[model samples]
Target: MSSRPRRPAASSSGVHLLSSTRVITALVSAAQLGEDDLVIDFGAGPGTITAPLARTGSRVLAVERDARFVADLRRRFDDRPRVRVVHDDLRTVRLPRRAFAVVASIPFAVTTPLLRRLLTPGASGFSRAELVVEWGLAKRLTAARPRDLESAWWSCRFVLTVRRRVPAECFTPAPRVDAAHLAVRRRSEVDRRTSSILWAVLSAAYARPSAPARVSLQGVAPRRITHRLLGGLPAAEVPAAVWLALAQTLAADRNVIPPRGMP
Candidate 1:
């Protein structure tokens, strides 16, 4: 029998190569890929996850910043026409104009920035993503009430959840903390107008995150509606759904113009 190909050593760039084929397979399977889908493997370290993603017959864009791994990934997937290897920084890479899904075990560092590229409101054609991220970060992202403004904004347009926890030993040169499988899927029901309105509301509320919702949202909505929706909760503790409802209420009313200058 042929021995499994050896994986390269971990790099200073925070690439922790998943050591177990079983774990890699499980991550890919959760993506539910097929021939018609387009998928991206961010930080495609030595093509471990890329290989299985290709097997699903989905068009795979294996993006890696490291030159050595880019070369190795090219050579490994050369025979697979469906796999396209792109050497670029994940943070700055241009996302697909067409609909796409992401299935990746990203580097531990730069997790937040990378996700911002994919999940930020108005990001083009991002349908779903299954990411392996730091456990603490995952918990914060999937919390009942988003602690930060960005997480709250992201939750408005996508559903963020922790699918499962992955042990540290699953990777080479194990990380200090365990990781979690984070699932993100865009909210199909949220239209462009709703997203824009939510961004406005969330930005205003989070501007004074510690303040009571009524105070933060003062001029943005009617006192009766704001009080009815938010009650006594602090702006930071207000759920994304409530934010969305507030935006929708504002959108329905012709008199209330949504706050301008969305970032």
Candidate 2:
């Protein structure tokens, strides 16, 4: 008879395993997944979130970077065909080509990069996500006005909101601070063209974030139009909605051309 593989040592990769079943259930339930949905559980350490996610009847991609957890995950879900244990870095894992939802308690260390991959403009087939991220990051993402260009750009394409707080005690090796349930959904109303335009305009405006919106947006639209749309507000103070309006207006103008290299 063949012997089973020995369990590997604990990871030092900044992953805190989810120890609270109630928290796990709540997080998975919030995803509202069905069999039709395809979900990716980033940082699926020991199948904590992955198990409940599978119970939802959705196809689950349990992505883990550590070899130990990967082995454990594969063994735990071997009987469950719907759960595919992927032993790969979440940072580089291939996202689904079809529309998909994400229900995972991702690692705090790679929160920004993971979000960038999923929420960046033109990321194909990404439908929506409910992620467990650092509390500070959650607040920044859902802020009334994004603090930086990247955050603003993401806001132009998606609606980011905080669902609830996940206390630190919920994890086995509790983190220093609490986590938050950050919900991300694409802006169905905004089309590809509008998103492209927002990217161009916002990129220009944020280049000189302290400048008056009219001056910052002069390259994209006529000064008169920018002045009308933005008034005297600084580029930093301009919200995503106003930026969208500007992009939409620019998109409607036949005379105006998008900046070279714009998608």
Candidate 3:
């Protein structure tokens, strides 16, 4: 975990300043936060976003994976009763069934898993809350990264608005790529069919060693490969479970060669 003071000057302007105090204030104000909501700031580095969210009179679970950063956050918000610092892996960390919103300075790699955990079913899943995260990997889902893009798109529909081209120079060790803000409100339930389709696509793609090449063949490769590999497997109009079974079977067979899905 890295530590840096809130740059009062740099915090006031620029697109890269999404996590800055000023930007967070604006975001929260725009959100019209409910007073009782629990706002979880995932990957809270130095409590920049945490501080303002706490001011909303909402309890804030400031989750930071870094030991050093968690210590710093505790010391910073020691007096604020509303702030609770959780030092653990945000990915697997479980919380009580308390309703809350989530504000994240997300790590690009784990974004999908985190979103699924929040929106999917069961006790470990989050019920309802406003969410803010990066828009990376938000494009249409493919067989290769089905769950990845599926989760991103599922959350995207609830997005009332987005702030794009946020500058990258706002952090101490600034990231190379620009970031965007996705202001999301959780949906009641995710579409099971859509999620199923996405999983089928991705599971099949990743199973193949030449996944990148196979996925680039566009929509034709899955059908063509299914046919050639499964003795002319018919169109996938059947139940998703049946298609999933077929996809799993084909994906696990290394002997089945696939056409180039990408150039």
Candidate 4:
């Protein structure tokens, strides 16, 4: 069996400084964090956002991989009961089993995979996430509600919103591009196997809107994939919901899946 991932050495490019007091205040207010909340500050660098988060009366776990930042965080929150320093790579740490919120000015490099860990089907105890990420990525994610070809398959599992745009100047290092506050709220649960099939089918279909929607299921009779299951709609016109419903219906019977062709 494969062991869990190990903590990684901190990357220089991954470290951008988010130390503006004004921005921090605005983010904390927007998140509505309080004493009752448990928040994970992923990529917590030098205790910038983490310090303010700790002040919000919320229980804060600051995850940092750099030894320098981890040492600083430990010293900064040494006497505080509610603030804990996790000197490990955020990607390697599994979120606590108890329900928690995420408020992080995350490293730009790890945004996608970290989101997968938080938003994938069947994950538990995830209440919400307020993230500061690249503007382009956030725009793509929220371009269409749960329908954008890339995010659509996972969209039903969470309510993701791009709240506002943040300027590059907000960070000390000043990233070449702008960033945004992306909020994600967990919604109702769907069957894990069904969710997997949905992505699998879409993964195969990665079809251009103009192309015919093709789903190649091996061994299963083509007759089983009738117009009814396909929503009687052309491939390009099919909504994410339709794809999900179709995959769910198909997944209930067997281990059938898409042929795996998407990039």
lDDT of 4 by residue, 28-112 (tens): 7778987989999998877767777877899999898889878867876788888889888888897899989998888888998
- Pitting candidate 3 against candidate 4, the one with the higher TM-score is 4
* Models sorted by TM-score, best on top: 1, 2, 4, 3
Candidate scoring better on TM-score of 2 and 3: 2
User: What is the alpha-carbon lDDT of model 1 when measured against the actual structure?
Assistant: 0.84
Candidate 3, residue 82: CA error in Å?
1.1
Query: lDDT tens digits, residues 41-141, model 3?
Result: 77776677777777778888998787877888999888888889999877887865766677666665666687666654423324344334444543322
How far does residue 155 in candidate 1 sit from its true spot (Å)?
A: 1.3
Model 2 off-target regions past 4 Å?
Answer: 1-12, 254-263
lDDT by residue (1-263, candidate 2, tens digit) is 11122222345876676677776777788788999999999988877788778878899999988898888788788888899999898889888889988888888888888888888746578888888889998998887677778888888788888988989987767889999988888988777666777788888888888888788777577888888889988877888788877888877876766554443
Candidate with the larger lDDT of 1 and 4: 1
RMSD of each: 2.3, 3.7, 10.2, 7.7
Task: Report the Cα lDDT for candidate 3.
Answer: 0.53
Q: lDDT per prediction?
A: 0.84, 0.80, 0.53, 0.71
Against the correct fold, how does model 2 do in TM-score? 0.91
Runs in model 3 with CA error above 4 Å?
A: 1-5, 8-19, 122-135, 139-161, 188-263
Measured with C-alpha atoms, the lDDT of residue 87 in candidate 4 is 83
Highest-TM-score candidate:
1
- The 10-residue segment with the lowest total lDDT in model 3: 8-17
All candidates: TM-score: 0.93, 0.91, 0.58, 0.73
